[model samples]
Target: WNIENIIDNATLKYSVNFVEDVVNLDVSPGASGIGCTEMVISNLGTITIDVDVEVSGDNITISPGAVSVTLAPEGNITTPICALALTRSEARAHPVSVLALGRETNTHLNQVQVTSNFTAIVDPYARLSIQAPMPAKHCIGSTFWTNFTGVNNGNANDSVVFEVSNIQELEDAGFTFTLPILQYQLEPALLDPLKQNSFQNLVIKVDSENVTEGYYNMIVTIATTMDGESFSAATTYQIWMANCQEQDANIEDDSLPSISLIPTLIAIGIIAMRRRY
Candidate 1:
């Protein structure tokens, strides 16, 4: 065992070190309709590295797959990352991941990785729709009530605004609208149907105590706006003027059927004609 003493030397290695921002990356509209952000990645290790990046999410893309970094202890690169929604109805923030993988330039070893998590911004979309049934006829001189169903089909919480499109025309034709002129707030449409308040009644008074036998048509509209996007819906109301008779509520006629009914003679004739059409 006299000549067996020998010395051996080994090198200690450090893995590649990388750094990235863990923040809410703001998204801006890209050339067509896609949303994107500029990502800054840095190398914080002693060795130079060649890195490749990746993303995990729907419609997400990274501009350059790989970049070379020289280390003065820190080297940075800027790249464009983009994301988008599959449909206009889909609006909300979504979470995604950014992955950086790298290896030392000289030995092609000391492999390492870094992960950055973020949320992509997609503004909420809002839409409104109104549905009202055709109303029944009543005596021309009494007041009446009509109603409509408002639906917020958009993916966010929003209110619907009401407008009487042909307000002046109908008013000139011996009709009046009390509901559209008033404020009716709507519950956010994103709630469950069973817990939603989406129905409303419109009131009108006919000064028909001396009007004619014809009818006037009324127009109603519902609308909403969000983040520069707009949506609107419309419905029609017809006012039938006949010294008909008396029955229930005593409301006039414009966007609703009155509570009262006309005489049996007028009802019978109109019922027969209505059956044919």
Candidate 2:
């Protein structure tokens, strides 16, 4: 019998599945974050397959972006793929695709490929900061007003409301607060191109008309919210309530924590990128 050679095409059957349809990521405002899940690849056909996996997304990165594996019939491989999102000032839902290419032993026989998708969700957050100038000493029974700043430190659009956190404390100490504007709408803070802080300015007025001759304190606060979550920030001060007629030596001048001015430019929202971190 004469020796003869026969050739036939081999089929590579494979299946791909993600652990879940959605992966949740909690990232700070203007920050990068990572989310990971398992992906399983199975070989179903009679022939072994060398499979290569790849993933892609917008403004985000997939770790081990590409992977290769050799599987036998009825064999499977499970690997974790991570999504590293880029710096963002707002929350968003992103869709990423997973593609698998299988070659029968890389023999270049016909190649079969499959594609699937998973969603990456970034959650929104709220943050705030308030700054006021505290004078070293103020004469008793004198009206005091100073310009202060309130910044929307969060990564989303929000409204900030101004209030006196220690109303009773200030009131009992013969002090009262009056503000022309109480609420303000602000946008996300930008770290670059001017280092926009989404900052707002207001004048704080206090009536020190009542008689006093001791140390007094007051707290100024700003508040905002996101998804029913409350966020509040405040600045406080302690002043020596000495009689205007008293000598300078009679006033206490110990400064606590040295509360100071708010810089016009604040570096905010430093996010991570590229690899799974």
Candidate 3:
């Protein structure tokens, strides 16, 4: 049953026709020797129509002398990576489509056309996790260690590099010397995998300097392999004068010295009284 014959000689009837329906279709003609013209007709319910036609050209021969093709319009593809915040101005984000080439009817044409429809919306998909033996604030003279964990939900391992900086301004702002000045590093232990579920840690050390008791601030900057790509995070630690100040003040307030002499004196007096009796 050729499509050209059915459209040309069939009777199409409508059980109910209330309003006017107009069908419109457009198709790009194929190359000189490669593609064929696609025709489509749409109506409410079913339409039975009668037609008479004659073919004159040898190149225009019809198939079964025709074929039936169900025309389905392309649909929108959902982009999951859209949730990540990507800098579209500096970077272009792309997606992996599920539709494979072999399954496509028109491999080259349809696949390319469908790929154009997939979209990715940008968001903050990059995540960071920091861990350390102690909090960011430590004594100025004390050595404290910390770890920073980062994940490129946006890219893979070796995709980004990191840096650590010592900020003196953090001390001027009131960070205590009791809390050591901080430094940071990305640990080698965390760089094996680069997935949304994967993460790497940055090990940080706060080495307190032998200076006035004050606080300090530290910053960690992460950059792409090229350094131009970077992000930053920070923590604080401090060192202060020893804790013996209060103990020194308390000693000064004692009215008398705490001595064992009183017990020896009283025992001697009792022995002398017994001897006299």
C-alpha TM-scores of all predictions: 0.59, 0.69, 0.32
User: lDDT value for candidate 2?
Assistant: 0.72
> Candidate 3 lDDT, tens digit per residue, 55-143?
11222222212222222222111111111221211122223121111112232221111011122221212333333234333443456
RMSD each, Å: 13.8, 20.2, 17.1
Worst 10 residues of 3 by lDDT: 13-22
lDDT of 1: 0.55
Error of 2 at 61 (Å): 3.2
TM-score: model 3 vs. ground truth: 0.32
lDDT of 2 by residue, 116-180 (tens): 77888866677888887774467788887767678876666778888877888778777877867
Which scores better on lDDT, 1 or 3? 1
Of the pair 2 and 3, which is ahead by lDDT? 2
> How high is the CA lDDT of each candidate model?
0.55, 0.72, 0.32
Candidate 2 has which clashing residue pairs, if any? none
lDDT of 1 by residue, 1-277 (tens): 0111111112212222222222222222232335565566555555466666676654544334344444333666666655555444335566666566666667766566655555555565566677765866757776767666667666556656677788787676666555545345555444555445643445543354545567666677878755566778888877676665532324434446445644666789999999999
Q: Point out the higher-scoring one by TM-score: 1 or 2.
A: 2
Error of 2 at 238 (Å): 4.5
